[model samples]
Target: MLPTKMTEALNNQFNNELQAAHAYKAMATYFSDKGYQGFANFYLVQSKEEDFHAMKFYHFLVTMGEKPVIQGLLEPKSVFENALDVVKQSLEQEKEVTRDIYSLVTLAEELKEHSTKAFLDWFIKEQIEEEDAFRTIIVKLSGIQEGGEYFLKMDEDFSQRTME
Candidate 1:
């Protein structure tokens, strides 16, 4: 059984993951509107991944004998000045997720919930990869001019990104 505080926090994380999915979908549409198919594909994949993450929380809650609560999400930003702007915002989002995961881990530690803490280790590793991926994208965008060969190549590479 999950402690009350841990249950509430996990539910919040679950909702945040859904919100991240919503945000990524908005970003996908932004890229698609601009005719950047590759970029759109990348964000689309991200949106799906967020959904998967949310489901993990839902299942965890269920297995822990708690009912998961669904909550509303804030509206995502639709306007971005450039690819760099989008990447920066995504990096910030990832960092926020990382923070959330860390908070959950800390809660588990405080509660002496070893099972929960072990489960959260996966998310900790995931956040590291998520932040690293966005940071890498930011680096790439910072070094290239939009509509240039390098940018096009990078987009093409991103288009190949598949959810594992």
Candidate 2:
């Protein structure tokens, strides 16, 4: 059995994940418009990942006998000066997400909801990987001139991480 408060929080978190997916889709469009196809593909993949995360929460809520509510997502910015800026903003957004996840975990602990904590453990590890990956990319971007061969090569490398 799940606590009522925890269930409501999970629904909100699910919607937030969906909103993050929307934000990544907007960023992908911005990259594509700037001719960074590789980065655009990266964000497209990110959007998909976010969608999966939302679904994960939704499934969990269903398993807990809670109704998953859909909330309205706000529009995200579609313009950035360059790939670095886009990814930097993404890293910051991800950090914010990590904070939210941590808060949920803490709440679960306070409420003696061990199941919620166990599920959130996966997200805690995943966030660590996400933040480190972007931090490394941001550092690499620091050395490369924007729109140059280096940028193109980096984009290609990033694109290789995507499915198909």
Candidate 3:
């Protein structure tokens, strides 16, 4: 049986994932409004990926014999100084998630919940990938000249992004 503490933590992470999807959707709209259709497409795919992550947690909770609790979402940030600002904020958000996942791993280790640790192993690896992706985008955004040909080419490149 899952411990109450662990169950609650997992539920919170599940809700966080859903919240991320909402935020990504907002970012998608922000991009679309700015006429960056490729960036918008990227955010849309990211939103879908967040939804998939949430569902994975839900299913995992069920398999672990815990009833997952659903929660309402708050409004996502809709305004940004610029496209680069959006990616910078996203990197911070990803770092926050990485910290949370690491905390969960520490908790699982402390509890000696081997199964939970094993389950979270996947998330630990996934978090690394997530953070790397955001950081890479931040670097790209930082180095490129905005509103230039490079910007358009990068946007076009991003347009082909798909969910993994």
Model 3, 68-156: lDDT tens digits are 99999999999999999988888788888888888888888888878888988888888889889988888888888877898999889
Candidate 2: worst-modelled 10 consecutive residues by lDDT:
155-164
Task: Name the lDDT of candidate 3.
Answer: 0.89
Superposing every Cα of model 1 onto the true structure, what RMSD results?
0.8
Query: Which pairs clash inside model 3?
Result: none
- Ranked by TM-score, the better of candidates 1 and 2 is 1
Report the Cα lDDT for residue 126, model 2: 85
Candidate 1 residue lDDT tens string, 5-41: 9999999999999999999999998888988889999
Residue pairs in steric clash, candidate 1? none
What lDDT score belongs to each candidate, Candidate 1 first? 0.92, 0.89, 0.89
Each candidate structure's TM-score, on Cα atoms with residue i matched to residue i, is 0.97, 0.96, 0.96
Which predicted model would earn the best lDDT? 1
Off-target runs (Cα >4 Å) in candidate 3 are: none
lDDT tens digits, residue span 1-164, model 2: 58888988888899999999999999999978888888888989999999999999999989878899999989899978877898899999999999989989988999999989999998999899889988998999989999889999988876776643
Which prediction has the highest TM-score against the true structure?
Answer: 1
| Model 1 C-alpha lDDT versus the unseen true structure | 0.92
